[model samples]
Target: MVLVISVTVSFFWLWFIKRFETSTRLTGKPSVIFSLFLCGIGSVFAALFLAELEELLLSHVAFLSPLTYYVFYVGLCEEFGKFLVFYLAASLTDMTKEPKDGLLQAAAVALGFAILENILYSDWGLGILLLRSVMATTGHMSFAVIWGYAAGLYLYSKRAGKNKYSFGMVIGAVCTAAVFHGLYDYFLGMDLKPISFLLDAIVLSISVYILRSLKGRSPYESGDKEAVAEAIESNSNNFHLNRLAGVQALKTRDFETAAKYFKKASTVNHREISTKVCLLFTELLTGSVEEFEAYRTLDRICSSINVSNLNRLRARIAEVFAGCPDEERLLNLIDDLIDETGYRELLKERIAQFDKYANAIAGKGCADSGFLISDKNSLPMAYRHPSFYTKENNE
Candidate 1:
């Protein structure tokens, strides 16, 4: 009965932490299940190996005090073991993409470790189970968060091309988590009830602080909009930054520059449908049909293009022009979208430009039609319409 309750409670805690993940769509159920299994196995082996080492050291090191052994040796072994599992999980999968994922996965590893530890300590009966459930298990999780936050920052920096900073963060995170874990054990090992309780409170408080801080910094949070925007603006290699810049450039009819940025963004994260679509359009407009064809072969954008869906329409137009297999069907789809959405006039204008550019590319080449302008002054007359591609007056 006690074992059942403990396991159930531990799993509940896992579920609770997972519930707050930033994006379930990004971290699917299968990934979570796999992580839980791997971490659980890792924790069991880590415990067995550490147990042997502990006995060997105790026999040889006569001068070592209980406090010293608990703080340095025991704490280091446990924390380092948990961290290894966490690091492996982070590196092996896309599960650690966001800050919240780092926190959640780190917590998952600690919980898995604690669950086995709890089962072993269960011989002490219900009181031990209750105490371990609330304090010991939670303590492991709390300490893990320090490293988890660092793991998240590392991944974020790596994506943003801050390699040196990310490497430093990884080292710092491991050290911090180990130190905290050691300190927590050292306090409890003292066996002084009042002091131990006070230290527990302090440790718990710090854990809560870390959790709240990571949550606030999550990219998916509405309150962190400014932070996300800042990341996009400042990080040149950042996918969001490149995507936004490409969109702005496209709006101003800078097809060449827009294509360059969108291509970069797509390269960084190919799964992005919008970026793929925009890149295709910009490439086609700039008369890079062969290059565009190669890009399409890299990934098939299967989503339907709706006239009412401005973004998808842009991509569909690019698809139609790029000679997608179902070119006739796509054109019919566009016609239906235009008719249904009452955007006939706008569609007609865009279609006219597309036809003109196509004819020019077939005859004089893409560069002569002004689709691939090498300089601002070389922009074609058709694309220079003030109401359309001209950004100065519009802005």
Candidate 2:
């Protein structure tokens, strides 16, 4: 009954957190479920680990102060384990960009842990439930949310290529989260007399306030006209070139440049341009989650289109391109796209080429999302037209 009550309290808090963050880009169900699973597993591991430490404490190891013992045995090990769980869950999933997704996942896991811990303590009464809800449960959620939000930020901001600095930042964030978790636990464990809970409440409140303040308008604000104009021009110039150069780049396996050129071309306000280029580029360049930002930017650019059917069709195609790798998957996706876009003949021809290319690449779908990398090829200016890649290249 106590476990149930604890879970109930957690559920309400989770609901409230989700509700509050709905307007933000962080939202998803899969992430939440997976995070809870991680928490459940992590809690079991933590309990076992803590039990061993308790045994050590009872046995009396020489020169081991309570603070020193707690730091290594309780604080560091358990907190680090929880962060590890968060990272593991993220690395395995595709919804990595769903912003506050990490927070939800972490909170769920912590809540699951809290529920189990409450049950173990035999404090299933409403009073204990209420107490845990106000203090322990809230503490778990707050710490997890802090770590999760930082993970989300790191994941979102991370770019491709092996940079030591980038890798370090990710590692650093995880470690810092562990430190924060440790400090919280350590302070709670300390004999702070009557003011301990008050201190905790103040700390949690202050941390939350800081995090909320950290969120505001992005530097990549959607309303920036000058930046948008420059982006349009840059994309147009890149697009107004030959398809073979981009294709050759793919063949040579220079996916990053290929993605850049393809993206450049796709950005132009050109109706003659096939959204397929963007879709294909995204598929080839799927390694970087930053591609989602590009996709979102492209989507925003297309918001003015009268062709809702085409727009939705292309958007769905981009999504599939982001996830699937199998040639069969691409074929099925293309067929669905054609059916939706009412581009039967154009799509059929494209499909034939797509199939041939798929066969040639031998089931090598987009390298990252749909960006393919290869050696640079000299693409003639005349090849810029959408018709060029469709007709001449097939020959």
Best by lDDT: 1
lDDT of 1 by residue, 1-395 (tens): 76777677677777767656755543233547336535855775775687577778677676877666666677777877777777776677655555567677777888888888888888887887877776777777777777777776677566556553556776677677667666666766666646656666676687678777777776545335444544553344557656766665655567787788889888988877667766765665677766436344323463234445644555545542454344454344334434533443454466467557765555444654446533433556555452353223335
In model 1, what is the error at residue 63, expressed in angstroms? Answer: 3.6
Count of residue pairs whose backbone atoms collide, per candidate: 0, 30
lDDT of 2 by residue, 1-395 (tens): 55566677877776755443422232123325535544555565764675576667667666756555555555455555566666766677543332344555666666666665566656456765566655777666666666666666565444221121354555565455445555555555675524546645664685466445433321122313332233233223423332323343454456665566565555543453344444354444556545445444444543334345555555644443443344354444444434433433464565456445545554345343232524112224343233344322654
List candidate 1 stretches off by more than 4 Å. 23-30, 54-59, 93-95, 155-161, 166-175, 186-198, 220-395
Q: Quote model 1's TM-score.
A: 0.57
Query: Local error of candidate 2 at 193, Å?
Result: 5.6
TM-score (all chains, Cα) for each model? 0.57, 0.47
Q: Which stretches of candidate 2 lie over 4 Å from their true place?
A: 1-4, 20-42, 50-60, 98-100, 123-130, 159-194, 210-395
Number of the top TM-score candidate: 1
Whole-model Cα lDDT of every candidate shown, in order:
0.63, 0.50
